[model samples]
Target: MNGTLTLDGFCHRLAADPLRYRKLHPVAMAGEFVDHFGVPPFPRMEGIAGLLDRSGIGTVVLSHETGGLRGYHVGTRDGGYLIHVDASEGRVGQEHTALHEAYEVMRERLHDLHPRIGLAAGISLCRQADRFAAATLMQPYWFAIFAEASGLDVVALQASYGRSYASLTIRLAEVMRHQPLLAVLYERGPQAERPPGMPGQVSEGLRATVVARTPGFRLRMQRRPLSALRGLLPRRGAPPPPGSVAERVALTGRPAAVDRVSGYDLWRADDLAVLARPVIWGGQVAKVSVVAVPYRDRSVLLPQFANAAFERTFHAHQVL
Candidate 1:
């Protein structure tokens, strides 16, 4: 649980204390499963490693016979389950399917034990299995330790982890959820229409999604055109739109600032700054991560405050 995480070390710990994880959360269970058996995240996994040992998985049948289905969990007459993973799918896809099917098989058992659980819960359980799959690959416990030592150097971490930019940033947001900050993702895509005649048309722009935040920090007016951000500012003095800088950063896909945000005024900062970086995916700027950067000097210039690696990483694949 300290320093660099390793598959062998994690397995040793889990084996040493099996009862400790007997009643684990879904996310934790996924992490432990991958940690215990070294399930494929990036590098290729040997023929169905983790799923083979699971009791719930009666048999892992690799087939394209499920009528184009990548993976399917089928229950037998003897009340056993068979997980069919795609024979044509890559290692990563297979890993996800296997984990998802495994969770689904277990969910079926839980429902049988409590008939009142309801069919509506099946959809929710499936969605939870998706979460479990994500957690299995990018375990938060390991990610937290890695991020801390690396100064939350996201660019390096993303490359190392071999995950999508959004996945890495969103996980970073989750890791910092209890701290004094607001982590948001702004993606450039087709804009959704506003309430009729509500605003000037700015078709095709960045749309913001709140990834995670500390309990104290809140931004109700988070949107494509952050015009309502004016209300979030202190009313004592006539203030400019706080959203301009962030909007520009999202639009331009760079680190920028309007002015130095006063300490403890916005984002609950003693020494912090708004740092935005382009979330590059497949050689294009698809999204941006706008988050608070912990810094000593409040007067540092816009892009200079941004990490060199972070800045350079996106600039290679500039704004779309």
Candidate 2:
């Protein structure tokens, strides 16, 4: 392969023969990094976090009285990293956001790897490798086992996994890419359809915009209750609802709106109130969005700082 992996080719390979490639490249990246830098093995998230700390990526708690959203990152003048994660997002019980941030950091470092490929290919590989790594590490089968052993539902999963609704939902979707049970759960969940006067169909542009604008954008997928899968693993917790607003928007095909002011109130209550709006495309709601609200006393707004930075940098090059 010699690291010539094209994005479209990698995606096609993943779709065509997912299992064979599932643990291949990301694991390769890990192996290469360890061989080059002599880093210790990371058997779990905490281990990876520790590795990041040693690699000069600093993890810090960011407190700004915002109530709705979870985690984000800031760059340091010294070219190091500072990750700001909300404690509220932590309440969702999974570590999706943290993992996402960590993946980003990893991608940044991948660019600095020796004998680098062309910029376009290198960046694409880095991001895809991060996704691949995350999917491999948090396989849905493992989640099923964990949920069974621990008795965690969506709410409990949030508690145990330390992930937010959006992150967890997206993670579940990623898991479905490999596991049949998760695939079934995702397929059987409620799906959204557009109203007659709405957009005709969904598009990638619409999806990106909605995701960019929404808070907790990850939560729009249907989640499976851990309690129902007891026989597949071992049983543990009470079940919660299976679907989220993103899933609902996709299923109902309706454009939804959220009042950020009211959302602020919920946020101030420390409830991590996430508000979502739908992006209409081709006569349908193409995507659902979520954003964390600041405290009740504060004004509701886009995560301007983070969003602006992401918009400026994300996809800066056609290859990335």
Off by over 4 Å in 2: 1-50, 65-70, 91-94, 115-141, 144-194, 197-320
Error of 2 at 284 (Å): 22
Q: Judging by TM-score against the true structure, name the best candidate.
A: 1
Candidate 2: worst-modelled 10 consecutive residues by lDDT: 311-320
RMSD of 2: 19.4
Tens-place lDDT digits, model 2, residues 1-320: 22223222332333344353332355443343344333343235465456546556456444554355555567788777776656654322224445556555555544454224222345575455445344534455566555444222233344565543344444544433322211011111233453344444321122221112122222111144654333221111211112333334455554222222121122333222233334355785543443333223113232323222211211111010
Encode model 1's per-residue lDDT on 190-264: one tens digit a residue. Answer: 655543433332223456543555564543324425554433432212211234344455455565532334333
